[model samples]
Target: MYVAVKGGETAIARSWDLLAAARRGDESVPELTLAQIRQQMRLAVARVMQEGSLYDEELAALALKQAAGDSMEAIFLLRAFRTTLPRFASSLPLDTAAMRVRRRVSGTFKDVPGGQILGPTADYTQRLLDFSLAEPSVPAQPARAAAPLPDALPCVLEVLDREGLIEADLPPAGDPDPVDLTREPLMFPAGRPARLQNLARGDEGWLLGLAYSTQRGYAESHPFAGEIRMGEVSVFVCPEELGFEIDIGEITLTECQMINQFGGSKRAPPQFTRGYGLSFGEAERKAMAMALVDRSLRAEELGEAAHAPAQQAEFALCHSDNVEASGFVQHLKLPHYVDFQAELSLIRALRAQNPQEPTHD
Candidate 1:
């Protein structure tokens, strides 16, 4: 019973009807198909996959439709569905170096191992609204090269890595398994892997704000975009019985590697530290934001100061999940009649104790 309201079920059913009506808009207008959302509204689908911790484009698109395009609601729906799925064996480490390059760019150097490919980017385009797109028109298609690109293109960071200018990514001793954050609660004093996992599944707007803070000098930050690569990488999973890896399929990914200056200490030499971010699709902004935040959170491990909220692992990871945050914040909408009444009585008593002054009239 919602606050002892009568016929709550009827109200709820009516509410659902209203939601559906609104979602459909005009009945004459064609309803958006799942394929349309998956292909046309790709970024929305990507965000739902990233934050929901699920990688199914179809499901993400469905969730978006069910939620009527409310991203937070869509994420909640996707996660709810994901909870019912059975887990298979963990996949092998993704070989990003072997990714089929679609878009690759680096800010650190003029040229990288493979020449920068500005593939299907709107970054250089004017921000003016194109009224022409409002009408149905034939879309333009890009020309393909005579020859196919190499199967494997060297990572842009390799240029810096060769000279030992950037820090090496040495695996921790014993090579422990990374934390499955979805299964385990994020405890305080979380490790790099845990932080990375949280950030990967974190809310984009929240991460973006924190990442922007680092750039604005909220933390000791002079980060450079070493590379941003968007491509399709093969996913391999090894079955315990098979005893060998099998390529399941390919998924589009956007990877960002940020290089930041770090002063040398007694135990280490001066070199550029790395901040890494990976997204499920061509989510360049999200990937870049994740990398910046990843670096800031490494402040303690790198023997630097944690002067910002993003640097604090507990704060960062706890609030990263928009689902949880939204729940807590939105719960206020629920009936709180008793609590409100109690507060009302107390406030009345307090006001009675401190009577108002006599009016001049």
Candidate 2:
């Protein structure tokens, strides 16, 4: 017999007020506008959009502001808001070869077509904190040569494909409709499309840890960074009434192709297998981690032993969602008085019955 706890409404309202005050700390400092957050904190905005499965930068920025710069909270807010919007259309698959490449790099080849463009990366920068960023200063401009870029850049994997060194990237025969994880419950023994869909919006930190485990001999495979390209790609949607595809918009994307050496299987010869990852913006680390995890999940398909946690599709895909993980973990903070009280009563009754047996204490 547990009694219900009461008097939380007024306290909850007061807590909201306190939260608002804390979120807007130091009144003298100017408040951050959505535009400022959208532009300056573009990476954060991109991440929220990616994880939330919503492309609106404005909404993402608002979510970030409302959540006080907590990326996961911002993602949650954006995802909740996304549930209200009606789905009007589904876009055709993007063509990465035709992307207006801003940044491109490859680890396997020394001279890839389109020449390695190291656009706006912190990879070469010193890790030490730069105190100069605190003070405003005139930025220095560097001289540059104007050159027109190619319409389409050849993929590194395509080069391997020509020589019969890698497996052909072909859709399965009969080309079945892909499972939309949003509309359908994620069933076990998921195909590549469903697995990639889950991993696309999966928590970056969680995926990173799983990927790191693979490299540390959990599911060791010689992997090469075939190519990583970040740029803007056009999106197209074909409306039923229109009966033709139309260019809807363009969005920034980071695509990664990982090539892993695979031994000969019963059905095929020794060749290179591929892992792919695509993200909303210049999320190189996330994309790379996703690629590693993607490849790991394909262990069964490739006829390899699923000896590691990362290689286990069910474990990886089911736990990848941060929103689900956060909700389950945070729910513990909610009132559990009734449930605990029941357990308490049961324990007390058992102890009273066993009083003579515990007399040694």
Candidate 3:
């Protein structure tokens, strides 16, 4: 009789040690510092912080290094670490109007009041391989005075309201208490608009691929990024007892507004609708994709065809979490002997019962 497997504990411990060593790399080489990861791999850190739903740049940088530049894995690592963090006072809703923007652009208008700041972007960078900088040297940069911050532009809607173009004249109500998704299981018809807040804080590569698939006619492709803004948004928390808002902190965010022109259906008049995307860092592509996906998800609301995969709220929202998707996909590597054995036994029994079954055919 075969004995049950034993002494697996020691093997498991050894395997863990090996994994740790591999992650750390050689002892002779200088250890990868968090600062190095933060400065050099800024995009990775930004992604981690965005998807991880935490705004700590330093921690995000460390997670990126630990995950070896795997944005999804780094997000998971950061999120897992975030769970252990102490619960501080929840901040109030951020006022995007008060956002001290580093960069802001509007596709709708070429020239706005404050003018445009292109900032750092790879939009025009050629994909050619650069072999010149084998050894990097810092060049002295010119010092310049800090640019003056622009005052918030009155909401574009306000302009329409003044001209009697809009039916409503009320100022935009600030986002009320936002809900946290990590603490709860995603329920059916999930309404956490705050939870879907990632268009601001999501992984750029992942979002870009999803957006590309749509453009390739895999999903709804008709979309235009109305505006993409990157800047700081202030967070405030007002306790019930305090009865007043208190400033918490500021976080860098990328916000995208997508416009989809919809024709009037039998039921409603044609109107310009909005889809919003927001994230924690310079994630314009992600935010734009998110806005498109968001509008696509509003097929029901817009009284449009809801047959497309992008139009399915359940599928899109449920599968959107990169951590959940990555975990389930990767978990297949774990031992599955018991399930495999069951399938094998069933197959053998079926085969034995049908001896004349055409094996070759």
Candidate 4:
């Protein structure tokens, strides 16, 4: 005799109230404003925007606040809200070459055209917590250089390409429409565009793990960070009525170019292969991880052995979404009384039939 639980509606309503109260916390502390989150917690806002596939900083800030500072929840909220918005026009492929770079670095070369600019990084900062930040105050700023950084810096990969050290970057014959993962199911043997799209919104920790696995002898990739540039890029959209591309806005972006050593194959000669990653804002870790995973997923194309989990496109793309992962993992809390009862009955009947031997205490 199975009895269904009632009062679900009332319970859910109360749960919402509880959640609201918890989110608000103590009234003594000042409530966090959306503007403060947008300005101060800019990195968090950037991550939500990037993963949520929405460029609105204000909306991302609101989502972060509503999510109680949980980035995954913020991303989910932003994504859900994005689905309700009407699509106007698709943007043209971004031009990274013309980016107004604020930070740029290369691991392969000693000196690049415009010397490496280590802008606003905590890499060299000590791990110790600063107690002074509890009562925050404006700090003196360093004087800026009179001249601005070069608008366009030469790509490190291009320098190698000139020396015939890397494979030539040739575009496909015709510009084809990219598969929209949001609307369509991600099929295996995915093209670069589809894989990149999936990786861009993929969970950071998961991607980081996969990337780390590759470095730990999972894959044989002699990879070098060719270039990593962080700055602003203009977004353009072509409306059907206008029949001309229009600059919609500018977005902060991080672009990584990874060069991997490739042995000569039957079809192609020995050359350095390329892996690319581009994301919204200054997400160097995510971008770098994406690049590593990108290269690993290209094993088939490069005629290399696909032995690692990261090398499998089906595994990588399918398990990347945090929203899906959270849902599946959390669903264990759901009632399974019927199934458990059946298992319990089966186990008891089997025990009665086959008298188990008593263990010596």
**Per-structure clash totals for the candidates:** 0, 0, 8, 0
Per-residue lDDT tens digits of candidate 3, residues 112-210? 666666767787689777776566667769554277666564343334336543334233588455456667665666453743653344445555665
Candidate maximizing TM-score? 1
Ranking by TM-score: 1, 4, 2, 3
lDDT of 4 by residue, 1-361 (tens): 1223445898979988999999999979999999999988988998898889888899999999999999988998998889899987889988898998888899999888888888878888998998988897897697675578887887777888888889877777895888998788788779999999999989888888998998888988778999999999999999999999999889999999889999979978898998888888889998999999999999989888999999999998899988788767765667878999999999999999999898998
**Candidate 4, which segments miss by more than 4 Å at Cα?**
1-7, 139-143, 358-361
lDDT-best of 1 and 3? 1
* Candidate 4 pairs with clashing backbones: none
lDDT, candidate 2, equals: 0.89
Tell me which of candidates 2 and 4 scores higher on TM-score: 4
- In order, candidate lDDTs are 0.90, 0.89, 0.69, 0.88
Candidate 4's displacement at residue 292, Å, is: 0.1
Worst 10 residues of 2 by lDDT: 1-10
Candidate 2: tens digits of C-alpha lDDT, residues 1-361: 1223345899978988999999999999999999999878988998898899888899999999999999988998888888899998899988888898888899999988778888878899989999998987696796453676666677867889999999998887998879998889899889999999999999999999999998989997668899999989999999999999999889999999999989979998999999889999879998999999999999989999899999999899999888888887777777888999999999999989878654464
TM-score of each: 0.95, 0.93, 0.84, 0.94
For the record, the alpha-carbon RMSD of candidate 1 to the native fold, in angstroms, is: 2.5
Per-residue lDDT over 1-361 for candidate 1, one digit per residue giving the tens place of the 0 to 100 score: 0122344898989988998999999989999999999999999999999999999999999999989999989999998889999987788999998999988999988877868788867999999999998998787797785467788889888777889988887786898998888899888888889899999989999999999999998887999999999999999999999999999999999999999999977877999999999999879999999999999999988899898988888887888899989888777788878999999999999989999987896
Best by lDDT: 1
